[model samples]
Target chain A: MTLPILQLRAVGKSYGTVRVLKGVDLDVKRGEIVSLIGPSGSGKTTLLRCINFLEAYDEGEVWIKGQLLGYHSKGRTPQDRDSEAVIAEVRRPVSMVFQQFNLWPHMTVLGNVAAPLVLAKKINKTEAHRLAGLALERVGLAAKVDAYPAQLSGGQQQRVGIARALAIEPEVMLLDEPTSALDPELVEEVLSVIRELAHEGMTMVMVTHEMSFAAKISDHVVFMEAGRIVEAGPPARLFGKSATPRIQQFLKPWLDRSLSI
Target chain B: MNVSPEHIELLWRYINAMLVTLGVSLLAAFIGMAIGFLLNVLRICYPRQLSIPYRLLVWLIRGTPYFSQLMIVYFGLPVIGLTLSATQATVASLALYSSVYFAEIFRSGWNSIAPGHLEAAQAFGINRWQSLRHIEMPQALIFALPLLGNQTVLVIKESAVASVITLPELTMTTGEIVSATYDYVGPYALLILCYWLLAQTIALAVRGCATLLTSPQRTL
Candidate 1:
């Protein structure tokens, strides 16, 4: 049996006493596009963050290519947490594209994309720049390489964020509302890039509110609510005939809107 | 306007004192900026170890007046057998005083950086030091430029306070020239001109640096 590229076995997280993720079990096989659809505050973003150990889940295991991350055991104490170096090593195969397009304003497009490779992977400047150039080209941003992020439009800046994530050559890509921050006119450009990545068989777990886009591109659709997975299935099954009442109710507005459109 | 030749010659003789003033200011600014940079990094990255001590140092230095701090370093420390020369005491006190402000400048700069930038770095597997070097420091320094320029001028002006310790800096030399020549007006006027020119030069240099750091067309 082929192992999943990313796995979350009963993952759970909380802030103070408010539990955010309650036993989230998920697996993304290679060449899969899993779309996480949910209402606001449904822990979709938190789940994506936990996959790369960016948020540090307090319960269960996150396995990237079969290696556990962030903690050695289920223990949540400070002592039980792994060293930063170890955590980085385990999560190196995963990259994330954020909602805010957190491009460093001081850096040019090439510098922003090349920085991760140079700093994290120990790649030399020339080689990192070459890779960054290719990534930018893939995102249709080759001309903007010399431009500062502030000089670009919001759509263009988000493309730079995607290029930065792509330069690392990740095994799995996690996207947390990648197009939510863009203007309505600018959203299609970013969505097209994501759709292209999906067609190329990039393993992606994306949290999105764009129901139509998610339904069209996702191999698997997982609906979440109140920090739990209410339903999970193929796009056809989840969108055409969801078994759970909560997911049906949650997706009602989106489904109706898409139908009306 | 019967300006005496002796008075002109004495004023010219104070050039060495002006050099001494500039030298001490340069040294103090360099050392103080270095300390402030290290302290800010320590507080941000290793807060568990250095946060309390960092807060205490900022409070102690910023709470006291610069002159009093200078006196404490120059005179009070002698009680504990830590005696410094007049120049040494002046530089130390000035460095400590400026470091407090520099530290706050760096802290504010670092805080101004968007949280998303650091999050993106962490997601890419960049280590903490690498994140600071590649992402945080450049942007923070850029954000802090205007304030840093103001602090540089402040340091240069405060160097004049070294006159209290009998150090032959610019202000002390001007005082000496006036006392000997009995021409207070000429010597004081010349001193003001010299200081104004020095401040303007520093201001011009800082503007150049700010342009270099922040010019968007410069690229990476």
Candidate 2:
């Protein structure tokens, strides 16, 4: 069997005394779309953050392409942790799109997209701009290259956020509630961009509230509740014939809303 | 308000002193901004170690009067064997005075940036220095522009305090002319006019900079 591109082994994270992620174990292959769905405070976002080492997991380990992230050991102490430069290098293959569409408001769209290339990848300015132009074109924001984030609508700004992530050419894209901050109309445009990326065989781990979209695109759906994974399997099995009562109860509101629509 | 040839000659003689006043203010502003930038960076990078000392220094500089600070630099320092020339003492005191205010302006500007901007920079795997240069510093400087302009104006006005140290700047030169010609109203009024014109020029230049820095096209 081929080794998974990303793996999480009993990952746990805590804030002081309160635990946010409780023993999360997961795996992702080369080209898979894994949708993490749960109610708020269920640690879905924390789990996604751990995968990219954005939030260091206190117990267990996260491995991307077989290299440990955040720590050299599972020991819960500052001495066991890797240096920041080492952490950055180990997680170089991953890029994240934040829920708030965290584009630098002071920069133009092209500058925002080109920033990661120039700053992280150490690419030359002229080539970075060329690649950034391509990424913007991919998101259909080619004309808004010189436009600032404040001038764009919510949907357009989120697209620029996605362009920024794509400019780095990451092997896995982690999106934390990409559409949660968008308006009803604007959500569709951002969703379509992700859907297109999914079709092109991009590996993604997403925390999303759109159950219908998740059921449609997800190869596997992992249901989380109160910082633990309650059920994990294909969307057809989980959404169509859920084994756990917790998952069934969780999906009922979403199912009812979809049927009515 | 009589038109006298003597007053005109005195004014002409003192033009170089006006230039010296302008030069001292400019030098102080430059040095103060540089020191303030360094202090802000140290505070941000090592808050635990530098915060108390940084805050205390700012308080000490700001609490005391500017003239007293100038006197200390010029007179008191000689007791400690650190004697400085008049111009040196004046510029040193002025720079120290201006840095504290500049540091506070920069701190407020840094606080105004959204936390997400820095997070985004980190998520992109940019190092600390790159993040500061490409994201944090540009935005912070833009936010600080108006207050920075105000500080520049204050610095120019405060250069007058250097007159006590016999720096031969505008105010001191005007006093010399007044004593020589024994014409109080004419020389004093001319001194006020020169200072006013100088202040107006600084204000105009600062406004131009603020507009350029805050403009969307120029910022990008």
Candidate 3:
């Protein structure tokens, strides 16, 4: 078995009295696509944010490429801090695609893709643009290299968002409902690109509402409710035979629709 | 009373001098703004560093009168043996004054961006500097343009105060011409006209730039 590229152990996050994530553990192996399916506000997005240290966790550890992230201890007290030093360390191998397609509106497509290569990776501008052009071409946005975010449709923008993620050559990519903001017709275009990335062996942990897509593409489907995963396994056994009533109830309508279609 | 032909010639000369003064002020403003922008970025990224000393400098320059600041640079520097030309003193004072206000304007503009934007950038492996250069600074500049325009116009007017140090700028030339003729009204009136025209031109340019900045698909 290939070693996992990412792991979250006993992860918990709370904002004041509300516990958003509670002792959740998850892992993503290299070249595997894992789908995180849950109700709204169920900590799916929070977990992704925590992996990249975008949201600091209250407890637990995240390991990326074998490095224990943000686990600092001088005295017995242990400090929970998201310093730039720690964030930069964790962010080196991970990239995220946001739900809103947060492309820098001021930058051209090439600029958006080339910036990280030049600034973070310390590559020259000429080589950065060259690589960025290649990444854009992979996502079929080569023609729109000079275009801005406002010029593109919802699907195209999401593809650009994906291209931006790919330009960095990340080991693990976290996508937080990447297609949620798209129109129904535009949804498949974004999903197909994601599907292509999965086929290319990109390790992805996706937060998705589309159960059918999750079932079809996911190597491991995790069913989350409230703030914890209740069922997780291969799509066939888990979706065909949900042991818990909660899992059954959640999957019933989704299964019926898939069967009808 | 007939406006003297020599006064008309002097008025034209005053215009030329004011143009030079404006150029100096523009350079100073640009330099000050560049430094102030660096400070603003540091303060935003690390709020703890924006200490009382930093705030005091901003407040001191912004609080004190611009003319007094010019006086300090012109006369006080001479007392310390770092004597600058009148034009240099004027540029230094106005630039320092405008930069403090520019820094505050930038700070406010940076605060206005949605946090989601930064999060998205972080997730994309575009580190801190990349995010600011490509994402944050451009957006903040767009929001700060109108205020920057107002500051630019103020810098131009403040160049008149340099005339006190005998800088041969518009106001100084007007004073010299009026004192010689004993008819201060004509030359000073034209000075006021010159300032009004300059301010209006800068204002129009600022509005035009702001329009293009906010327009869709133009930046790319």
- Interface RMSD list for the candidates: 1.9, 2.0, 3.3
TM-scores, chain A, per candidate = 0.98, 0.98, 0.95
lDDT of 2 by residue, B144-190 (tens): 87788789878988998888878899889988877877988977888
Fnat for each predicted structure, in order: 0.77, 0.58, 0.54
TM-score of structure candidate 2: 0.91
Give per-residue lDDT, candidate 2, residue B32.
Answer: 95
Overall lDDT per candidate, in order of appearance: 0.89, 0.90, 0.82
Q: Which numbered prediction scores highest in TM-score against the true structure?
A: 1
lDDT of 3 at B121: 69
Tens digit of per-residue lDDT, candidate 3, span A103-164: 87777888788877877778898899898999999889999988888889999999988998
Q: Which stretches of candidate 2 lie over 4 Å from their true place?
A: B1-7, B10-17, B168-200, B210-220
User: Can you give the TM-score per candidate against the true fold?
Assistant: 0.91, 0.91, 0.81
lDDT of 1 by residue, A1-261 (tens): 999999888889999999999999999999999999888998999998999888989888899999998887768877899999999999988888999999888889998999888888999988999999999999999999889988999999999999998999998889989999999999999999999998888999999998889999999999988889988989999888887887788778887887899
- The numbered model that scores best in DockQ is 1
Residues forming the 10-long window of minimal summed lDDT in candidate 1 chain A = A69-78
**In model 2, how large is the Cα lDDT of residue A231?**
94
**Candidate 2 local lDDT, A109-161, one digit each (tens):** 98899888988898998899999999999999999998989999999999999
Q: In what order do the candidates fall by TM-score, top score first? A: 1, 2, 3
Residue pairs whose backbone atoms clash in candidate 1 = none
Task: Calculate DockQ per candidate and list them.
Answer: 0.60, 0.51, 0.35
Ranking by lDDT: 2, 1, 3
